[model samples]
Target: MTDATAIDTTGYLALVRRKRLYGTLLLAVFAALMASGFYVADDRNAGGFFDGLHRIFDFPAEIFSEAFQNWRNLPGLFLKFIPSLIETLNIAAVSTLFGALLAMAMALLSTRGLALWPRLTPLFRRMMDVMRAVPEIVIALVLIFLLGGGPVPAMIAIAFHTTGALGKLFSEVAENADTKPVEGLASVGGNWVQRMWFGVLPQVAPNWSSYALLRFEINIRASAILGFVGSGGIGYDLKTALQWGQGKYDQVVAIFALLFLTIMIVDHFSDRARARLVKGGRRA
Candidate 1:
């Protein structure tokens, strides 16, 4: 019995050491992979990291210097770009509204037990996956080529991406919902729409609204980027100003300030709104 106990202890210690050694080897391999990837990326880059590190602030310095020299024009520049800024905001808002509505329908259709057609749930899920996988830029570029440059293309592109993203999140939330309400409604001969509208929507509305608001924030940035690549909004103006170089640096500064302020405002409001939504949801 003493010898058996000794053998068991020795085996246990060996197993533990083997596991530790394997874990260490895995970590070492991961580190090596990361190091190699960074080296490869650096090699392929047009400018080396260390080479550009010091000059990183050169552009910002130039913009600030020019803006300071022409500080009086900042307000005028802001007003000039206000129309473009509105276009950007409109694109984001319209896309979010349409996308959230579409996502709500898709979410209900894809969710188990809530689905009107359970067999087609997989189909709707795959459709959302495909929509999500296709980046906003790709759709924007394609639509731009086909329809010409405008906010319409950007709006559609962002909406498509938002639908897929929100659909998945909304469906996940629906899955956790209490089916008792739905069951009770159905017992009273409620149709699918009635069951969902009267039952699921109330439970999921706050979370859905929160997600939509967050998507609105992301869509705003995406719309601006799309505008730069296509045409329309402050991004296009920024791109144009950038092309003019030193002489138009003031305009560039103004654009940056506007973009920064807009983002800050949106982020602040969205944060507060989300907090309120979560608190309200918990209370309900």
Candidate 2:
């Protein structure tokens, strides 16, 4: 190779080494901070799990014993909460659908070279950052206060959070997309929407869909938690059952079973869907 080519390769290697060093330093700093935080939390009695390590299973034992005694009531209790379970499912499904759609639009808008109004990209980026920075429960509580407690609040909160998360992921995937198609479309006088729909979206669809599917599974759990915190859905029923204590423990068990089964099914479905999307699928 020429001396000039040798100098260029040396510069590239130096840049790579610098990046690796920075990454290592950042990771070391993060680990140090985490270690210090844990120590401080333990000192302040904020580490309850560590303090109560021996008795961790005490509550579970009591719950299981009570649930066992009322085994016959489990089926009835489970059936009773089916409607509430359905409500939770609806909340998750609706939020995911809307969130995915919003995320797609935002992803296209925020991504470099893909955005119509590229100058507004930074504004959209900050907007997504704010959305994800605020906790979903915080949003849910605000909505609950304004609109009253119900599935609507949980759905909106989850959707808002999902949009931020999925938007971030989708934008990253879009960034690595082949820009040639976009340029081609633009050269042919295709509008921004046409270029995105025909050029950008087709390339990124599978990855985006995979991320959305995983987010949907996560939102199911979020919906249940939000429902318990606010109102409406099986989580609210679970809360009520727990509040009633011993006599209603069986209902709690039923709700737990339903939640577990539902999560399991969704997880399996998401895994299969992702495999099909990214791997050309396995033959059954």
Model 1, residue 141: what's the lDDT? 91
- Candidate 1 lDDT over residue span 1-284, tens digit each: 99999999999999999999999999999999999999999999999989999999999999999999999999999999999999999999999999999999999999999999999999999999999899999999999899999899999999999999999999999999999999999999999999999999999999899999999999899988888996589899999999999889999999999999999999999999999996884455
| TM-score to true structure, per model | 0.93, 0.84
| Error in Å for residue 219 of model 1 | 0.9
lDDT (tens digit, per residue) of candidate 2 on 88-134: 99999999999999999999999998898999999999988988787
> TM-score of the candidate numbered 1?
0.93
Predicted structure 2, TM vs. truth: 0.84
lDDT of 1 at 197: 99
Which regions of candidate 2 fall more than 4 Å away from where they truly are?
1-39, 46-51, 282-284
| RMSD in Å for all candidates | 2.1, 5.6
Residue 272, candidate 1: Cα error in Å is 1.5
Clashes of each: 0, 0
Clashes of 1: 0
